[model samples]
Target chain A: MRIGELAERAGTTTRTLRYYESRGLLPARRAENGYRTYDEGDLRLIQQIRTLQDFGFDLEETRPFVDCLRAGHPAGDSCPASLAVYRRKLGELDALIGQLQSVRTEVGAQLARAELEASAELPGGPEPRCELGPTAPQSPVGPNWEDER
Target chain B: MRIGELAERAGTTTRTLRYYESRGLLPARRAENGYRTYDEGDLRLIQQIRTLQDFGFDLEETRPFVDCLRAGHPAGDSCPASLAVYRRKLGELDALIGQLQSVRTEVGAQLARAELEASAELPGGPEPRCELGPTAPQSPVGPNWEDER
Candidate 1:
């Protein structure tokens, strides 16, 4: 198949396929007419690259799996090198999740504090509140009764 | 102070300060000598921008807080606009963290499955295993008794 057909079948752009070729990832064979040609095996390779990219893998990080596929492994992760990349990516994801969680907590706390301060500065100070204990049922008029009136 | 001094105090490069100026986020005053000048207020604005950036805010997202500071608010988040930005950012962070967590779980599961498959393909098949229940006391030789020999 031609480069265009392979890219279409793989659900990617020809530019991306050319980029993979430039990276020496998916080298295409030259046909007698001097056009780039690809086989179904190359299509499988592209699919593998796309999957890892969707998982936030860097283009470079996909190299090991691509190499594994090219080496005729049953699957990309069938190679030790590919498995090692998976382990490394897992560690990276854990670190990123930890950092984001910390940031989320800090941002949440800051927003709460700022909101409290803003409410306190209102004409009547902080608004009145109710814990809504089990015995104290909600008002029959509903929570937005004032709006309805 | 000159642009260089402002950049140094803000712990940022002059190029970045210029970039912010281009974005109209930080406009500097023109000194009598035709050099770009900044004052303590500009320093505060730069600090506010830096803080939001460290919290993973995009350059555009920092605009609201910068505007609040420029409007003479006590803090960057004192204004309603800044508060709105905070709320939106909280939502965004929550979404991003959730996605990362899902990806983490998927990658972890993939790694475990791959590891199991790899081990099963070894000459002796999968390694023998022990759950190490509480009832089974630890061997004095430690977990690596074979290695100890």
Candidate 2:
């Protein structure tokens, strides 16, 4: 298959395929007419690359899986290298999710505090003399962000 | 204060401050000696920008807050414009958190499935059950990712 046909079959763009080729992750054979040609092996390698790419794997990280497939493994992740990539990816995802969860909490707290302060300035506002104290923290970012204040 | 002094006060880098200035987000006045000078109001604006930046807000998103502070408001987020930005940011954060949670679930499921399959292939693995059938989904990514396969 040609680049266009391969891209169409793989549900990806030619630009992406070209990028993969440039990264040497997916090399193409040159035909008699000076055009790129691909075999069933290339298609399988592409499938391996696309699968891990969708799983949030970097191009470099997908190399192990592609290599495993080219090595005639039953599945892209059938090799130890591929399994190690999966383990590393799991750790990265866990850390990222934790960080994002913390950011969400902090942002939510800041929003609540700002909204409260805004409402307190309106006429006939509720009595809030006890909650807001002189020595209390002013910024809605909370005390943990000592560098910000 | 000079750019370096302002960056030191804001707990940021002079390079970052200059980048902000380049983006026209934090403009500085030129002294008689062709040096950049900033006052207390500028310091407040930088602090506001840095606080929001630490909260994962983009430099452009911090504009309204900086404008509010430049207009002599008590805080960057004390104005209606800044409030609107806050509301929009909250929505974005909520959507992002939801997406991350979904990805986490998907990745956890993948990890568990891979681990189970790996253990199941070990020597003297669990009883040979009839449950391993063709109808079982192969990957946790679901059947929708058939394009990759």
Candidate 3:
């Protein structure tokens, strides 16, 4: 099969396939006509690379799996190097989640404090007041206004 | 104060100050010597921007806080617009944390399944065996090897 057919079958772009070839992750066979040709094995390798990329793995991190497949392994993760990448990715994800959770907590606290301050600056301190009063200060901002922007 | 003094007090670079001025976040006055001058209020605004940046907020996201300070608010978060930004940041952080956590779980499962498969493919299936045999296959990879790279 040609490069375009392999790319179409793998649901990826020809540019990506060329990039993989440049990176030596996918080595294509040169036909007598000097055109790049790939077989079903190349399709499986591209599919494995696409799956790992979707999981946020860097292109370099997918190399071990590609090497494993090229070495005739039934699956990309069949090699020790590929398993090592999986473990490292798990650690990175945990650290990132922890940092984001901390930021979320701090932002939530800041929002609550600001709302309290705004309420205190009002005339009645967020207490129930007569809505019919013409002189009442109407705040155009609301907690639900976050979605508007 | 001059631009240098303001940047020093704000603990940021003069280039950053100029960038902020370009963005209209910090408007500077021109002295008779044809040099840029800033006041204490500019320092306060720059401080607010830096603090939010430390919290992982984008330069554009700090605009509301800067506007709030320039509007004579006691603190950056005292304004409705700043609070809106905070609320939006919280939502974004939550979504990112959730995604990272999901990736963490998936990667953890993949690592476990791959390790189990590797052990099964080994001669003893991860069971304790005599270490005296020279013919026994040794795995060069370990879970702790993630730190070396």
Candidate 4:
């Protein structure tokens, strides 16, 4: 199919399809008029690409999986390397969850403190001391006090 | 005090102090040599700026808070606007936390499903149509299926 047809079928923009091609995630053969031609397998590949992206895998990370699909296996069992890829992605997801959870906890604590102080009617003086003390820690809030103040 | 002195006292870079001045987050007077000078109160303002930023307020959002501080509240209780600013920041933090939490849930579910599928041994041949269905929902593991197929 043509780029437009593929894009329409895949529910993505032609620009995105082009980008995937440029990133080597998709390979297309050129026709006589320089139009890109795609096989039925390309449709499956595009679906896979979309699925991986939804799962938070980047184009670079999806490359090995595309290669495996193209190789055509008689059985559903995949390459051992593919299993490793899934494991690595799982680890990354866990780390991301951990980081976000920490941010949520810290922000929740800060908001609670702010509410406490606001309700107490305590004369807001300089925070009893820096809420974040010496030795700054990484927080999703952005650059730490070490960089800010 | 000179910009350098203010930066040293505030534990911030001179460039950041200047950037804040340009952004109207900080006010400074230019001396004969065209050097920026700040007062003792500026140090407190810088500390407050850092505090707001730590709470996830961007430089733009901190403007109202800076203005409130500059207006000179008789006491911390005097600036009702400051409390509003904190409330606004709290809302933004809550939304951010909600977003991260949603993403974490989706990614965590995908990871669990991938692990389960990876460990299961499938019968050789066309995948059987089971209650779970032949076409699994598109997931990060889908693209990697190339490696598995």
Best by DockQ: 3
Candidate number of the best lDDT: 1
| Per-residue C-alpha lDDT of model 4 across residues B11-77, encoded as one tens digit per residue | 8899999788766577778899998878978888888788767655688766655665676743221
User: What is the per-residue lDDT of model 3 for residues A1-149, given as tens digits with 9 covering 90 to 100?
Assistant: 99888889998889888878777688878999999999999989998998898889989889888878877777888887787788778888888778788878888988898889778877666554223222222444522323212
Comparing 2 and 3 on DockQ, the stronger one? 3
All DockQ scores: 0.17, 0.15, 0.26, 0.08
Candidate 4 — which residues are off by over 4 angstroms? A55-57, A71-149, B74-99, B121-149
Candidate scoring better on lDDT of 1 and 4: 1
Local distance difference test values of all predictions, in order: 0.79, 0.72, 0.78, 0.64
TM-score of each: 0.81, 0.77, 0.79, 0.65
- In the predicted model 3, the residue pairs found to clash are none
Q: TM-scores for chain A, candidates in order? A: 0.82, 0.77, 0.79, 0.75
Q: Which stretches of candidate 3 lie over 4 Å from their true place?
A: A125-149, B125-149
Model 2 misplacement above 4 A: A124-149, B122-149
Q: Pick out the ten consecutive residues of candidate 3 chain A with the lowest summed lDDT.
A: A129-138
Report how far residue A91 has shifted in candidate 2, in Å. Answer: 1.7
Residue A7 miss distance in model 3 (angstroms): 2.3
Listed per candidate, the RMSD to the true structure in angstroms reads 15.3, 11.3, 9.0, 10.8
The docking quality of candidate 1, as DockQ, is 0.17
